[model samples]
Target: MTLDIVRLLELTGWRAFDVDDRGRVLAGSDESGSMQLVELADGERTDLTALPGAVTGRYLPGERAVVVQHDSDGDERAQLSLLRLDRTGPAELADLEPLVDDPKHVHRLLDVLPGRIVYATNRRNGVDFDVVIRSARSTEEHVLYDGGGLVGEVAVSPDSRYAALTVPAAPALSDQLLLADTMPETRADALRELTDRRAAARHLHLDWLPDASGLIVTSDFGSDRTRIELLEPRSGRRHPLVTSDSCDLSGSLSPDGATLLVQANDDGATRLALHDARTGAHRLDVEPPTDGWCGHPMPAPVWSPDSRFVALSFSGPTAPGDVLLVEAATGRCHPLTFSAAQLTGEDPVEPTAHRIPARDGESIPCFRYAPHEPDSRTAGSAVVIIHGGPESQSVRAFSPIVQALAARGHTVLVPNVRGSTGYGKRWYSADDTRDRLESVADLADLHAWLPTIGVDPDRVALWGGSYGGYMVLAGLAFQSGRWAAGVDIVGISSLESFLRNTAGYRRAHREREYGSLTEDADFLRAASPLNRVSAIAAPLFVIHGANDPRVPLSEAEQVVAAVRDNDLECELHVYQDEGHGLAKRRNRLDAYPKALDFLARHLSG
Candidate 1:
């Protein structure tokens, strides 16, 4: 039976953001066509914000209101607004009390206390993000740390006396920790650097200890994998709370400060456990109903104020995303949101993990999804989907697009090439800076290895968004004959133009991964797919958000124009209301079906 692409894409997933003391959950759900903020309590759901674009929020300390962060279209310059729980129904844009509404600069709400809220903003100079502490009641605000670089994470102490911040040290691979005095008026020396820049490693998830004695930090300072550490900011003493030899461990201290929730990422699967916060002793192992990926890069598990329960979102190959609540004492997990119940079918197809040997003797880890039902039209056809974030890994999570492709009888392969995180520190940094093209070579290696899996190389099509989109164009241009068609979405055409025209705040950070324009302009131009547009022989389809701050709309425009000048079949679809990717369902319904049609036309001989 052929699955309706529209129905498959419409299946909703939920994400838990914050859980209050009374166990009221602040979450994001797409049940209403677009992702909107909703408060879940006592088996009832109340829509909190019906504003434009997807909304994410955290509950205020009192649970009477929420701090909602919303952006226009898909433009990620999110503005902060306060929405009270006392509303009779779903609150509209007019009902939200604007907290920070500067459309020109980006404002990220970090942490909230009883009387104040702390956020990182580039309002000062529009390039550097300064940690700003603002009064929740008034307009008074002051910069807590104006040092430099992108502020990655921020946490305010329970007593509101101190603040902790983490900034990127080696871009995606490592971070430097900084501790600042919140009450700087009384002290001459305010900010202190806890980690040395020379020995920088990945340091993040800043959860301050309840008593302000130290912090439960997640860092891979002296090891290959990340572990939880108890760091005394004042004395600079460190103690390991969680350790793993093969997998990277991420942990969060419970609100009561008595327990620690630790999650280990072994390849793509997630293993969650609990520990004694003070002694680092193992307590209980949390077992979800199915094997799935959880924690980090996603919203971290949020603990209830009383520390009796922890709420987190979980997803797997067969499971769409749902918020889960785990009791701390018994380790019993219950699903708060059953998003899969709405879908009408057997479970989505599960992917099998495979290791394909590359030409350089390196093994590429990939997941393959076979068709649920075979179709003659797409027989021997395969889609090689690349993930965005050359730094991110394609984990075992529910993807409507991946499912939709398989339902149409196309073999889908998702590979974690070099530079994709979750394997180890060395693997992620393998394609950094000048070594960028090395990751793209992994695509070529995958193409050559396709015959062994019964997938015809001549029928293979490249598909991806963002950085993955760049890989699609690169594979089609550099290895033109290897692929039949390409679909690029908000992807960069020229690394030189991407670095030069990208938002100011993003340039310095992105430079750490992709080479710097000032020094590596020549190398960037040589590596860009647009530089070798004449070499591309495959038909191409491009989709882009006009307001994309990361990969500008000009990228899609220039590449499509150049490819068409070669008398090639290249089509471009621009969504004026979208940013980096399509957020609205209406745009997705039109864009994806068209892209699939393009693939069908090119893939069928």
Candidate 2:
């Protein structure tokens, strides 16, 4: 059965952020049309904030108010606002009291306590972020530490004495932990570096121990795979808490300080288990309804105040999205929300995992979504969907676009080329810096393997957004004859220009992965798809957000202009209200359907 592209795009999902003491969940949902902050309580959802883009929030101590983090359109310059729950009825947008409303700089909420809220901001200078602790009720705020890079994670000590900060290490794809004295009198003695700043490893601060003597951390310091570790900040002592032989592991300590919800990323699928927080001993394995993705977008598996149950968002091939409450002791699971109604009769396709052989003998992990009943008109046609981040992995999560394409009889192949995470550190960093093009080469290998899976080699199109978009263009330009058509969304066409035009704070971080602009100018230019646009053999559809801070709209304009200059079919759609992506539902409903139409017309032989 063919699914309506517009309706598929409109199907929404829920992500649980924080659960209050009263068993109320503060979540981000699109049940109200657009992604908004809503309160889930007593079998009903109360809208907290409404808008086009998704809003994240945390419940204040007493459940009387919430701290909301929202961005304008998709600009990603998030601002923090407080919404009081002392009203008799549902709250409106005007009810939000801005705590930090600066549109120019980015303000991210880290944690919320009784009377204070901690956040990271690039307000001082646009490039470096300073961790700040501000009073929840007043304008009193203090700069806790000025960690010259992005703060990846932060966990306040149990006794509220120190704040463990995760900052980017000197090298790319690595992070270090810094312990800050939250109440220190002298700025000189306020910050103490716990992890080695020069180490080529990544460390994430999950939560503090109940005694405040140590911290729960996930680090890949000595191993290629990340593992749970307990580190003492005072005496510089640390030990492994949890270890996995083949997969990376991470977990969160419960509020009662007894159990740890351990999650293992085994080749893109999650293995949920409960472990002893203190001894790191294996306890019970909590199985979800299906073998799918869980705790995505982070800040999930939230333990209830009494520590009886844990709540996390789950999404599988058939499940659109729902919140699952798992009993800690028995490992029983129950769904708090259901999204199956969104697709009344449609049976979403489940992907089969495969390791396709690459040219270099390296195996590229991929997920293939085959159509249940193939449409003869589009038979043998396939779409290769590339994931962005190059660091992000394409797990078994529900993707409406992928399902819609499959329902339309288009075989969709999602590959985690070379640099995708979840597999290991070596895999993610394999294509970094000077080795960037090696990843694009993986695309060529993927195309060559298309015919082996019954897909027509001449009818496969490339589809991706962001870094994935860059791969789509690179596949067409670098290996022009391999791909039939391409759909690029907010992609980087010119690596040189992208490095030069990207947001100031992001440029330095991105340069670490894409190579230095000043030193590697020649390499950047030679590798850019824009420079070789003349070689592109496929028709192109370029979609971009006008306010995108990362790639910028110029990336789209230049490529489209270049493609059109060659007298090739290049269509461009620029959304003025969006920034990095199609975060808003309405924009997605319009763009994705049109994109599918473009694919249908070009792929239908």
Which candidate wins on lDDT?
1
lDDT per residue as tens, model 2, 1-605: 34767777767788788776566777778866667777788898787775556788787775588888888878889999888877655455577888888999999999887878899999889988898888888999988889598788888876888999887777678888898997788877889989888888888647887888888888888899989888889987889989987998888788778888888887667788999988999999887765444434244567776778777877777667777777888787777787766776777788889999998779999999999999998889999999999788888878888988998899999999888988888898888888999999999899889989999999999999999999999999999888889999999999999999999999977887888988999999989999999999899999999989888999999999999999989999999989988877778888888899999999996
lDDT of 1 by residue, 234-349 (tens): 89999998898999889888877999999888668788888999999999988675445442325688898889888898777656678888889978777888866766456478
Error of 1 at 458 (Å): 0.8
> What lDDT is reached at residue 528 by model 2?
96
lDDT of 1: 0.86
Model 2 compared with the native: what TM-score? Answer: 0.97
Whole-model Cα lDDT of every candidate shown, in order: 0.86, 0.85
Report the CA-based lDDT of candidate 2 relative to the real structure.
0.85
Residue 592 in model 2: shift from native, Å?
A: 1.0
